[model samples]
Target: MRDLKDIELFLLDMDGTFYLGNKLLPGSIEFVDTLRKQGKNFMFLTNNSSNDSESYAEKLRKMGLDGKIEVFTSGDATGIFLKERYGTLRIFLVGTKKLAKTFEKYGHKIVQEDPEIVVLGYDTEINYEKLAKACIYLRKNLLYVATHPDINCPSLEGPLPDAGSYIALIEKSTGRLPDYIVGKPNPLMLEMVMKKTGVSREKIAMVGDRLYTDIEFARRSGILSILVLTGETTLEDLRNSSIKPDIVVENIGELAKLLQKESGE
Candidate 1:
C-alpha cells in the first residue's frame, strides 16, 4: 500500500465518509480542514444520481460544510461518458426528472419511446408504470446502462432502495442487465475524478465505509483506500472481506489524528 503522504487528492464518499444524513461524522470537518491546511485537495463523490451537484452542494451547506457546485456524482460521470461514446443518442431514462435534465444538458436526446439506450439511476419517484415501460423497452432490445449498482442508499432513516435495486428488478424481469454500469468500482468514475482534479490514479485516495463500492474501487483503480468503521460496515465485515483497504480507522477523527501525528503537528 502507498503511504497516505503521497496522496494528492482525496475522493470522499458522501453518505459514509462525510455525513450520514443530517449529521456530520465526527472529525469530518476537521479532516477537511487539516487537508486544506496542508494544501491537499478533496471532493465529495457519490453514486447517488437522484439529485444534481447543486442539490448536493446545498445539502452540504445545510450540513455546515463549505462546498461548490462542481461536486461529483455518478450521474454526472455517466452522462459525460455516454455523451462521449454515444453522442446524440435517444435515451429512455429511469431516474428522477433532474437526472433526465442532466442527460439533456449533455446534449443527449431524451425520449420516452423507442430509445437507443435505457439509463437507470436512483429514482426516488419511481412508479410501477415507469418500471413496466423500462422492462418493455429492454425486452424490445434497447441497450441498457446503470449509473451505479448500489442496492441501498444510506440515510438518516436507514437504508433505502437505490438504483441497483431497481436494476436488479428490471434485469430479473427481462433476463438482461445493463451493458455498462458507470459508477464506483468502475474505472470510468475514477477517470472522471482524475480528469476533473488533474490528479493521477497513483496520487489519489478513496475513503469510505463500504468495501465493495469504495475499497474495491480503489483496489481496481490502483489508488489508496481508507475504510472508516463509522458507517455501514463493521470491523468484523472488514476482517472477512476479500477487498481490503490500505488503512482502516474508527472514523474520520482518528484518521485526522493519524495525519497530524505523521506530520508531527
Candidate 2:
C-alpha cells in the first residue's frame, strides 16, 4: 500500500486479469486510462508465448485498448536472451509463427537437423514431427530452452496444456530439462522489461492473477506486486500460497482507484 506512490510503471497480465476469452474484463480500460492520467506507465507483460506482440496489440485494439501501448511476451523475452547469449547458434525452435518470427527478427537461424540449441515456446501448432525432433535433439544433448514454465493456460473451456507440459514430456523422454527457462518467475522477463522501459526495479509494480508466475516474478525481481481476484486466483488461492502480493484487489479497477488516492490524483 505504501509502495503505490513509488510505482512509476505497472506490468499487467492480460488473459485472466484483463480479459477472458474474447471479452475484456470490467474496468480494465478505465484502469489503464486512470493510470495514464496519473502520469504512471503500464505494460502488458504476458507469459503467453503463443502469440507475438503485434497480434496482442490487435487483440487489445479490438477490446478498445490503445494500439500504441507496448505489450511484452515470453517469446519477446526469449528473443532478447538469445540475441545476447547465443545469437549465432543454429536453433531448432518449436513454437508458433510468432515465436519463429521473434527469433528470425533477432537474426537467429532456425534449423531442424541437429541444432546447437532447441528453443521451445507455446506451439499451438505442435505436431508429432516437431515434438519427436525436439526429443531427438534432447537425446543428442543439445541445449534446451523454454519460453516459460507454465503448466496450463486458462481457456473458456478449461485449462490447456502449456509449455511446461511439453517440457515435462521431453524431460521424461530424454531425462533432460531446459538449460534455461527465459520468462516470468525467472527474473529474465523483468530484466527485459527493465531494459525496454528504462525503469528501475523499485519503480515497477507487477500486477497479475497468477501466484507462481506473476507474483513470483515480482518477488524474485524485487518489484512490487498486486494480485487481482478477477482471474484464475481466488481469495482461497491467496491464503494457501507462500508468495504474498503487496496488494490484493477484486479487479484492476479497484487498484486504479487506490493508486489514484495514493498518488493524489
Candidate 3:
C-alpha cells in the first residue's frame, strides 16, 4: 500500500466525498486546509459535467469553503481529449448550457446538425429533442464520446440520470456505445492531473465515495484509494464488491486524522 505521508496530490470527488449539495462534509474544509498547511496539493475532481469548474468553485465559496483550490471536471478532461484528437470536427453535444459553453470555450464548435462527433454529458436540462437527436446521431454511428460512465448522479432529492444512463438509452435504441468514455476509472483524467502537477502516481491519491469510479480510478491509475462512507456506499457494499479501497474511513474527518498521523503531525 502507498503511504499517506508520501501523497502529494489528493484527487477528490465533490458530491459525496467532499460535500453533499450545499453542505460541506465534516472536516472537508479542514482536510483541504491541512493539505495546504502540509505543503501537499489537492484538486477537486468530479464526474458530474452538469456545471463548469467555476460554478462548483463558486458553490464552494458560498458554502464558506473559499480558497485558491482548483477544480477539474470530466467535462474538462473530455474537452482536452477532443481538442487534442478531433479539434477540427464540428461536434453535437447533449448537455446543459453550461457544459456546451465550456466545450465552446475549449475551442470545439457546437453545431446543430451535420456534426462529425457527438459528445454526451450529464445533461440536467435534457429534453426529448436532445435525446432524439442523440439517438439519431448514434444511429448514424458517428464518433461518440461521453464525459463519464456514472450511471446516476447523487442529488439531494434522489439519484439523477447521468451520461451513462443516456448511453444506455442510446445503446438500446441504436446498438452503439461510446467510442470512448473519458472520465474516472479510465485513468485519462488522472493522467492529465499528473501532467499538470508533475506528480507521480505513487505520490497522488484519490479520495471518493463510489467504488467503481473512485476506487477503480486509483486501481487503474496505480494510485492509492481512500473510500469514505459518507456517500452512497455502505460497509456491506464494500464487502460484497470486488473493487477494494486501499483505505477506508467514515468521512473526511477521519481521513484528516489519518493524514495527520501519517505525516507525524
Candidate 4:
C-alpha cells in the first residue's frame, strides 16, 4: 500500500464523501485545508450530472469552504467524451435544463427532432415525455450513452433513484442498454483528471463513502481508495463486500487529522 503521504492527488466524491446535500460533512473544509498546507493536490469529483461546475463551487463556498474551488462532474466528462468521439453531433439529452446547457457549452447541438445520439444524465427534471422521446430514439437504434451508473444517489431523505435506475427503466422499455456509461469505475473520469492535472495514477487517491462507484473506480483506475462511513456504506456492508478500500475512516475529520499528522503540523 502506498503511504498517505505519497498520495499527491486526492479525488473527492462530493455528495456523500465531502458533503451530504447542502451541508458540508465534518472536516471537509479541514481536509482540503490540510491538503493545501501540505502542498498536495485535490479536486472535487462527483457523478451527479444534473448541475454544472459553477453550481457546485458556489454551494461549497456557501457552505464555508473558501478558495477557488475546482469541481468536475460526470456531465462535464460526458460532454468531453462525446465531443472527442463524435465531434459535436446533434444530441437528444434526457436531463435538466442545466445539463442541456452543459452539452451546448461543449459545442453539441441539442435537438428534440432527429438527434444523432441519445444521451442520458441524472435528470432531476426527468419527465414521462422526455423518457418517451429517449426511448423512441433508442428504439431507432441511435447511439445511447449515460453520464454515470449510480443506481441511487444518497439523499437527506434516503437513497434516491439515479441515472442507473433510469437506465434500467430505459432497458425495460426499449430492450437497449447504454452503449457507453462514462463515469466512475469506467476510468474516463480519472483519465480526464490526469489530463487536467498531469497527475500519475499511483499518486492519486479516490476518497468517498460508496464502495461500488468510488472504491470500484479506484480499483479499476489503479488509484488508492479511501472509504468513509459518513454515507451509504456501513461496516457490515464493507465486511461482506468483495470491494475494499486501502483506508477507512469514520469521516473526513479523521482523514484530515491523519493528513495534518503526516505533514507534522
Q: For residues 83-188, write the lDDT of model 3, one tens digit per residue.
A: 8786755889999999988788788889988999989999999899988898888788799999999999998999987889999998898888999999998999
Q: Best candidate per lDDT, number? A: 4
Residue 117 in candidate 4, Cα distance off native in Å: 0.4
1 or 2: which has the higher TM-score? Answer: 2
Residue 157 Cα positional deviation in candidate 2, in Å, after optimal superposition: 0.7
Per-candidate clashes, comma-separated: 0, 0, 0, 0
User: What TM value does model 2 have?
Assistant: 0.97
lDDT of 2 at 43: 92
lDDT of candidate model 3 versus the reference: 0.90
Ranking by lDDT: 4, 3, 2, 1
- Give the least accurate 10-residue stretch of model 2, judged by summed lDDT: 81-90
Give a tens-digit lDDT track for model 2, residues 49-81.
989888998998987887357899998888888
Q: Higher lDDT: candidate 1 or 2?
A: 2
- TM-scores of all predicted structures: 0.96, 0.97, 0.97, 0.97
Question: Alpha carbon lDDT of residue 78, candidate 4?
Answer: 89
Looking at candidate 1, the ten consecutive residues that score lowest on lDDT are: 62-71
- lDDT string for model 4 (1-265, tens) is 9889999999999988898888988988788888988889888999999999888889999989998699989998889888888899899999989888888888998999999999999999999999999998899989999999999987899988999999999999999999999999789889888877898998999999999999999999999999999999999999999999999999998999988787787
